[model samples]
Target: MKLADKHTPTKEVKYGKALGGFVVAVNISMLLCLVTENLFSYGAAFVSLVGTLALFFDVMITLQFILLVLEIWSRFSRLNAALQDALYPHCTELFVGASPSYRCSLLQLQKTYVALGRAADHLMSHFGLPMAFDIAFCICGATCSSYEVLVKLLSDSDVPGLSIGMPVSISEVWLALHWLRILLLSLSCAAVEDTAAATGVILIRASVVPQRRTAEFDEFLRFTLHGPRTSFSAAGFVKIDRRLIVSALTVVVTYLIILGQLTFK
Candidate 1:
């Protein structure tokens, strides 16, 4: 996909590796914390082992989805940056104008971007349900724990007693950590769309030669803006944030339904 002479994308590659490693570390830390909590609270190694395995499964499920999203994002960013560096400021690569290699590069990039969009949709289709439930569990745990602490504090009505069974500060910190996790997850998902859309803008400038441009350049730019899969939203309806909200509501409704059934029984 090289139209102009340039060095390898070592920087972006390094960044992706670093970010991936960081995500793995953070998630593994979370898994270990859960396993440790269960071990101490239950005093049963088998129970903790089972719970650890379950959590580790969920972690892998969600982690793979997240890693794919990051990969798509990094690719889009790399594409845009390469386009800019090749044809920006002085528009130096204007001589490559109408060349087959240049056109082929653009065509290949467009195809790759479309493939990315399809992959995004597939990711949503394959892992979306599990991820939604996994996140819902986190939110539910945070909400329930906070409610328990508040209720107990109100009943005891004293700082020392409130801090006895559950350390008040630690509880607050734990709740805050989950909330932060949710926030970061949402933001990272959003960046996919942002980076994907920027590709078209870069192409418009990179492909054009001031006042002179070819049909292929125009077509690619137009395709970018109006293509079926311009970005993460191939259907224009697969927004992660919206899905997360729907997932949250589903979780709440199911909880209520179970409570109702149990009370009636």
Candidate 2:
């Protein structure tokens, strides 16, 4: 692919719509959480309603992703076509204005488009759609751990002088951690903003001027958002925060092992 163009009309409109839809989905999800706040008080009736609604929201999230895939696919095709066209006649002088890999940068972004496309496809299947489940499971575990810690803190045998237990409820801890988890998830929107910014810059560049020199530089900037793959190796993982995942795993494993031993013993 040529890897050098600043604007894509189809891509811009499609992704713009995807971003809007995702915003709506997130708002709806938050609303569901708010509505269920009083559910625990109602006991089984509340539980039944909340559980069914949760499943429905999960399905809706899946649909949001399907739309996302379509949006990305439309952009990727436009990019591929544009780049392939650009690569031929100007092959020799193409990236000469900038560094060679500067030209390769567009190719790299194309690769990212392909990678995300595949990931989206896998997400539509049975096994790959569990990212939401992972989010849910982590929230559940964190809530339970917080509640257990709160209980132990209040018990005289475990920690003296903290026995104001009557006022505390398990749901309070659950709600607090649930809110925090969602707040953290919102940070990922920062990534979307970066994507939007890059899309805007490139599209403007492509539409107004398709000149070789500036286009190369624009392509270079576009590829900055696509980090390298193969994150297991030393240099490969440098940009990624592997420690966060490692620490999370350590906590979950230690908690599970201790809980199991204490239960059986």
Candidate whose lDDT is highest: 1
Location of the lowest summed lDDT over 10 successive residues in candidate 2: 230-239
**Clashes per prediction?**
0, 6
Among all windows of ten consecutive residues in candidate 1, which has the lowest summed lDDT?
1-10
TM-score of candidate 1 relative to the true fold? 0.72
Per-model TM-score, in order, reads: 0.72, 0.33
lDDT of each: 0.61, 0.46
- Residue-level lDDT of model 2, residues 1-265, one tens digit each, is 1221234323353355665566566656654554455354455786768665875565456345434444444455465445545543454553354356546655555555545434534433532335455355554656455546555554646544444432344445444544434433333322333343454355444433344545544554445345332111112222212343444545656765676455436
Question: Runs in model 1 with CA error above 4 Å?
Answer: 1-11, 89-97, 152-156, 159-177, 204-212, 229-238, 242-265
Quality of model 2 by C-alpha lDDT: 0.46
User: In model 2, which runs have C-alpha deviations exceeding 4 angstroms?
Assistant: 1-46, 62-77, 92-251
True lDDT of residue 173, candidate 2: 43
